[model samples]
Target: PSNNETEQHSSQVDQIEEEPVRYELPLRTNRDVPPKRYTPEKEARRSRYPMANIAKGNLSPEAQIFTTSLYFEEISTSVEQALESKV
Candidate 1:
C-alpha cells in the first residue's frame, strides 16, 4: 500500500481506538423482591401432578380416609400381636 493510504488507514484505526468505549449498566430490577405474577403455565404444570396438590395440603376426602385407615390398621395390628404374644 502507498504511504498516504497507509497513513489514512492508521489514522482511521487511531481515531477508532481514541474514541471512548461506552459501557452500559446491566439491566436490573429496582425492587429487592421479584414481582409475583400468577402464571397459568406454572399452575398448569403443578396441576399435572397429583402429589403437588397433596403437598399443598389439598388432600381429597378419600385420600385422608385411606391414610388414617392405614395408620389405625398398623396400630391395631401391633396391639393384637402384643396381646397374642402375652397370651
Candidate 2:
C-alpha cells in the first residue's frame, strides 16, 4: 500500500471515530398520578357482585366439556370406520 492511501484511509477512520453518537429517546410523560381512593359505597358495591364481574364468555364450563366430548367421540368413530374398511 502507498503512504498516501494509508493516510487517507486512517483520516477517514479518524473522522468516523470523532463523530458524536446521538440517541433519540422517546419523550416521557408525567406518570406519577395518585391512585384512586375507594369510597365506602364503591367498596360495598364491588363486594356485592364479585362473581358477576367475572368474564365468562359465550360457552360455560359445562358446554365446553360437552363439546369436547362430542368431538372426541366423532374422531374415534371415524378412526373405527377407517380401520374396518382397511380390514
List TM-scores for all candidates, in order. Answer: 0.24, 0.29
Tens digits of per-residue lDDT for model 2, 1-87: 999999999999999889698898876664676656755565433476654454546779996677567656633358778787677
The numbered model that scores best in TM-score is: 2
- For all candidates, the clash counts are 0, 0
Go through the candidates in order and give each one's C-alpha lDDT. 0.69, 0.70
Worst 10 residues of 1 by lDDT: 48-57
Clashing pairs in 2: none
The TM-score obtained by model 2 is 0.29
In terms of lDDT, the best-performing candidate is: 2
Write candidate 1's Cα lDDT for 45-68 as tens digits. 445555334542466888778765
Distance from true location, Cα of 16 in model 1, Å:
4.8
**Where does candidate 1 stray beyond 4 Å?**
1-3, 19-23, 30-52, 55-65, 70-87
